[model samples]
Target: MSSAGPSPVRGGWLDPRKPFKDGVRPRKRQLGLALRDLCRLLHSDEPAETGRRPLKQAEAAKRLGCTADELSRYLNDTRIPSQDFLERLHKEAGTDAATSGQDVGITLEALLSLHTSALAERQGCEHCQEMSGRIDSLIQQVNAPCPQCAAHERRQEVRRRQLRRRQQRKLAIRLRSASKEQQTRLRLELAEVKVTVADLKAELAGKLATEAGLRERPAAAQPAGAQLPVPRRPGDRQLSARDVSAARQLVAQAEELDGSGREDLAFTLLQRSTAELLTPAETALVVVQLRCRERDRLADDLIHVYGRDQEKQDVMAVALELHEAGAPNDAGAVLRAALG
Candidate 1:
């Protein structure tokens, strides 16, 4: 007893009977409850139909143009009927009542409304509660510092720095072992890559300035139903002659880098050139040209072959490859050439 164990914590938690502040009801529960009420009303015995036979499940299903199992599922709340089904059901119920000379006092519209209300009620209480819990967790996380997380992040940063240092060391060793000619070629490629990167930065700055200018312009009023012209991004603009020339020069430099076995640097330069120098359509055309060149190379591999059947098979395979590469028209042309 000795001080009653610090007067046992009382009434700290929320009361279960207390209503939620938002007053939002779970849709599924509401729909289920509504369906239960409807089922009861439909299945209830009528005093006016005392001498008449009750509607059997099979008969009801037949009238509704559904299987007996489907009707049973609907009555058991295992399945909800579609609007069309509900409408048909209402008509059938009315017809049965009329034939039996009983007033059921329910309309198709009323049944449809009940169904719609049930569906509308289907927003989940659990989902809202989960969202609220997540928000509270986020707020708590934002307000507090987690020591374990901080330590983990520190360890990760240390590991990353160590890995980067190791990579740099390995690259330095490789460069030291490379031939003089290879080193000179690599240095030149590096300079070219730097130049291309600088060009890309300048182009990006110019595009941003253009976008800012457009944004500052006053909005013009137009007639109703008239659409404004869609603004084009810098990348979408046609490549100028200067751009094409620069792209060609970059491509030539990249080829030299590649031939010198500095493919990584070559790829970097190519990417920069593509971004800063080529229009979308021009890039696509370049891709098609490269693909065609590759196809021709593969075709040349089979040129020395003597078998017509083998050549036809190889050509058909190439056509299929072209078709898969988004050049169905080119694929057809290849097939036609093979036939010729």
Candidate 2:
């Protein structure tokens, strides 16, 4: 699922869990640098064009197979994304990780922390190599003439086979669902075309088999003057080129933050930047970033007004205090509810 848009931080605290899962530790400097870079995107916003929809957090969590809390934590800056998560983001969002400054050169082994020193390099944890080496030695012993691991491997293989079958079945179900949706859209388009042909036949006053009401016919089948698809009267503001350009630039800024070091800032900025125009969702982001996020005092004021929630106002106040005291996450969620 797509991130609600934008990066929150440049690089202060890389989610320790991400690199650990990848087997690498985040560099402190890299984390700090990144946070600083991404914080700038918090400053921009514009309106939206019709038909561009953003994925909600609940939907995103469901798609990612993560608990909403887990998704929120990752999103709300409690958890940093793993390499796998980043790959998923790139694949799903049509976002180029490199453009977002996610081109870290941590190797497959380093990325996975397969080597002891790799752990040391990322985490500054002393003697990770010794720990990795010990694990390796244990594996070696397990595979020796004593051999419990061989039996274990055979059992694991069987479980792996069962899991693969389960995955295939699920994939087939999803593919069928998607196919059905495509068919529905195609059918609608065809029906629309057929109505157009019938209307033309009717206009020529040739007897044609057809339904008799204006509302019953597809708008496209009506005479040229007929209205279609919620006819745009005046004041349907379309987004301009400058607005689109700002969004692109903001996206780049957010990415640089992800790479440079401030992920929290990147996440926040990403949210703000992605929705330049306001939706209920965008308004929510603005409300969160502008009124609530006191932690980023150095942060520009992006929100316009507060909707009436005493708890939200209180939360915002508390959050700002936390940020002033250097606790950003606490401040961020102070306003963003546990759900919604």
Candidate 3:
């Protein structure tokens, strides 16, 4: 006789009817089988009042406020239903048994105990299994307080606090790095501003000396333009001490107007002063002093007017100095435009 390839198996892999020691049936599978049987008995036949046939899986899920697919998963041991679903199922089973005049042979407490034990077993934690047993005992004894419940809640709260602290530490580290980058940028800007201010102060002093020298000249030897009225055309450099003083006062008033939120008026006044009262270098100095938003425009105009070979060389030197001083990108851009 031919030898049999292998003995035919009595059951498939994971047979629910097998004993626990056989290792073929797990607690979850057992729970799923029990729930499936309960639902089958509950939805077996319609009541006399309804005069309808048994409900389909979809209709049963609709009554339980769940989808057919979710019900299928719960019955197949592929997914665990929530505690609320278990409680609701137990109540429905009791109602069905009462209507049909038959016993469900399963209590709400017993169902819940099985569900908890199944979940604890799935986690493979001895502590969880112990807690599940303690909780189950308390349920059977009605109104009995559980000491371990408070301790479990406290441990969860401590873990949440530790996680929050770690997130805060990460955020603080990022902020500190950002603050360092900002400080470095501010320091570079401050140095550039200082260099520009020094250059402006020198130009203003030279203008002052020229005005003083004009005053020392004899009346007959003085330039004819000096005798002209205020508000002269551009390039008329014969400004008297009074005219210089008046121009300075006008700039001061413009600064006040700007500070008072009248920027349009201040800008108009500054344009008039630069066009008629002050020389190119003096205008540049005032623009720097006021820290005008239109400083780039005014600087560009000055660069074009200072068109002689020597003046162009001076512009180049100033641009190199500002670049070396680590001026901000905007300031450096203006200087580069002047060079071109």
Q: What is the TM-score of each candidate against the true structure?
A: 0.25, 0.20, 0.30
Error of 2 at 202 (Å): 1.0
- Give per-residue CA lDDT, model 2, range 36-98, as digits (tens): 222221121125634333344465556556666665444333245465754444344333233
Query: How much does each candidate deviate from the true structure in C-alpha RMSD?
Result: 30.0, 33.7, 20.6
Count of residue pairs whose backbone atoms collide, per candidate: 2, 52, 0
Per-residue CA lDDT of model 3 for 40-148, tens digit only, reads 4354453464652344678667777799888877766447788899888767766765676556666777777778778878778798767866866786777655679
Instruction: Give residue 223's error in model 2 in angstroms.
Output: 28
**Candidate 3, overall lDDT?**
0.56
After TM-score superposition, the amount by which residue 56's alpha carbon in candidate 1 deviates from its true location, in angstroms, is 99
- Of models 1 and 2, which has the larger lDDT? 1
lDDT of 3 at 98: 67
How big is the RMSD of model 3?
20.6
Return the TM-score for candidate 1, rounded to 2 decimals: 0.25
Which stretch of 10 consecutive residues in model 2 shows the poorest summed lDDT?
Answer: 37-46
What are the lDDT figures for the candidates, one per model?
A: 0.51, 0.42, 0.56
The local distance difference test score of model 2 is 0.42
The TM-score-based order of candidates, best leading, equals 3, 1, 2
Where does candidate 3 clash, by residue pair?
none
Sort the predicted structures by lDDT, highest score first. 3, 1, 2
